[model samples]
Target: MKERNHTTLTEFILLGFGSGLGLKEGPFVVFLVIYMTTTLGNTTMVFLISANSPLHISMYFFLMNLSFLDLCYSSTIAPKAMMSFLAGSKSISFHGCATQLFFFGLFASTEAFILAAMAYDRYTAICNPLLYPITMSKQVCIQLLVGSYVCGGVNSMVQTVFTFTLCFCGSNEIDHFFCDIPPLLSLSCTNTDINVLVLFTLSSLIIVSTSMVILVSYACIISAILRIRSAEGRHRAFSTCTSHMMSVILFYGTLTFIYAQPSSLSAPAQSKMVSVFYTLVIPMLNPLIYSLRNKDVREALGRTISSVFLK
Candidate 1:
């Protein structure tokens, strides 16, 4: 293996699902619809949450932040991807690729932290009901959101800086749709041992730590729910958590599969497909999951719609 110097590569060619069996206008159009729905769905959720619902409670507050993160994460990749598909130019300038990586990392990490905070919120509400209001006060929720963003921003900076530090003076073809660390590292002619190590360390920190926190919180929640004598009470309590659990499973499962494995086994096409789940499909589903099941959100949406139409 050769060591890579600090030389610069001007542009990167994205080998997006290249020559796959069923990739063409039909699939591209389908992706366009998914991208559009993701944007609109998340945007609608954010707007609805902000207005009409006085539930300035911690759960909805964190949800709003999650919606914002989803919108951002989707935007960071999907539009450029659509362009690549339509224009037959899957080329991204090096700086543009770095920019995508930065925002993608930032929003993704933020969402993970926010989800963990939400699990903790659920635990507080279920296990320590009396102290829920005090524990998840407005100030504390705001602090959590701020801290989430701060952590994400710092991590993004570190990852992006290190990722771009090595030279890509030879191959510029990235095998995935978006600029992800795994595929980007593959294109580098450098010995990316340090970069790979940093990526793995960061992945472990973000995924493992957050996941443990969420799991512990949920464990407490499940324990508290099981203590409820009535079957209906238990059912209702479990229902409230179902959406969050599903979202966590999908996001983390794909993330761990793509990142935790040896790069030798990484499949660019498969990674892109799964990336669509977390980045595009999840955003659309999250708003629906939170809003469709909750009466408060439904009322809020109704109020918002009425306010808009009547005015």
Candidate 2:
């Protein structure tokens, strides 16, 4: 048993880019731009999906929720991170850190499940088109969405309680931009074997399970596409899923690299770099990835612009 002084830690100093990472002004400006892009892009996605009647399907419903999640995801970490760089304000209250960790977990977990749900939607649409409406009915979609959020909330609640309850008698410095589980676990003075195990277990359960759903969904989707007799039909079917495939690959790849392994095997700089990708870059990229490959989105955007300008 490790001896801990049991002194209450009311706050933590975030050592985000504080150890001579780079000039503050440059990174601050870049992050500001990234945050703004994330906001605008995802907000536009949500609006376009919601306002356009043609886009009112299970796929677009999932996409709208995805955009909302990306917006929340980036907002959770980017604002504080940008502030840290520009304002030189690195200290965060204990409750504030907990809140941040909770929302970060909630949104990230929800997005993972939502991505799986989207994969499932694509699978049903392509693999079982005739049954798509019945299988992915409006009621079912709402249930899936609500279930994802609830599971996310539960995961965050458990993780937050586990993290904050750990004894922090030593340094209160968190070596990342936000209060993520890995960094916070490293800051604990008490024995963290349980915490680490819990983090890894819960993370694996959510990530691996959802990843399996995606993998299985895509596998079926591809098989069904291959069975199509016409080349044009095959292309059209596969095209609809490409955007989602890219999103899943980018999101799951980075997240797996970070959470799938224990922190001991990861260097702080390397970990932070990976974290920045999923937390900031990926959110900004998701809307672009979906829209650029999606004809419906392009046409809708053009129509919206034309309608507004020609009036």
Candidate 3:
């Protein structure tokens, strides 16, 4: 048994999806395409919601924020991953890893809470249409947005501080593409019992609490929808939530599978595959799902394009 000071470690070899898989070069092209689509799609969505007056309500407001987050956090991961591949260098500096982890956690946690807030927005809109405006007011919306970001920032700081504080072995080779808790934990030379505890505990606290909010809100919403007498009314009511539900399933499902389990890093190959889903695929899919499913978004997009062309 031998070791060196974690401080002496200047860089980490990010063996993304292992050494012999040939993932670095082959996936570069695919990830580049996905990253482009994610950027274009989310940017278009944010612009569409902001520029249009009709999409100014609570749901779209949350959606716009979600798009911005997806754009931001996806940029945090994808560009770095692609750059490392392009440079043909697996080494990421200590500060770079810290920065990547911070922004990734910040946006990811914020997006979790934002999804919860969106669920509550849907609940208010569908369950209590009469008081929807009063309940999810502009002031309240701002408060929720600020609260989500703050909570996420706090979580990010905690994870970053604790993670970097740990004594890592001299190997400095991370098993995955990005700097994540589980993979980083695998690098620690010291006992990581407390680290693992904090990781899973915070993960559960954020994921479960937000998930409960989404689940409970949707439950009440379902009850309210059932109470509607007209078939068209029920159908229309459920339609508003369908896109959010899909986003929820995809986003939360992957997150929970990865972070919610403490032993996630144990299965490096599987975790890396799933990481691709949330990191690359989900961001790319969100706007497509929303715009394709929701009539108002499609109509708004159409009108925006038409106005652009007419000028």
- TM-scores of all models? 0.92, 0.96, 0.97
Give a tens-digit lDDT track for model 2, residues 50-168.
Answer: 98999999999999999999999899999888877766457889999999999999999999999999999999998888999999999999999999999999999999999888888
Candidate 3 yields a Cα-based lDDT of 0.91
What is candidate 1's lDDT per residue for 1-311, written digit by digit as tens? Answer: 34545354578887676743233575578778987887887888788777754867788888888888988998898888777776656788988999999999999989989999999999998888899999999899989899989998988898899888877767788877789888888767767888888888887789899999999999999988989999999998888788789878977887787765557236667778887787788887888788888777888888888888999
The candidate that achieves the highest TM-score relative to the unseen native structure: 3
Structure candidate 2, residue pairs in collision: none
Please tell me which predicted candidate would have the highest lDDT against the true structure: 3
Worst 10 residues of 2 by lDDT: 1-10
Candidate 3 or 1, higher lDDT: 3
How accurate locally is residue 130 in candidate 3, as Cα lDDT from 0 to 100?
A: 96
Ranking by TM-score, best first? 3, 2, 1
Model 1 whole-model lDDT (C-alpha atoms)? 0.82
Cα lDDT, model 1, residue 259: 69
**Cα distance off (Å), candidate 3, residue 109:** 0.4
- Better-scoring candidate (TM-score), 1 or 3: 3
Measured over all alpha carbons after superposition, the RMSD of each candidate to the real structure, in angstroms, is 2.5, 1.9, 1.6
lDDT of 3 at 173: 84
- Which residue ranges in model 1 land beyond 4 Å of their true spot? 1-7, 19-24, 309-311
Q: Ten consecutive residues with minimal summed lDDT in candidate 1? A: 19-28
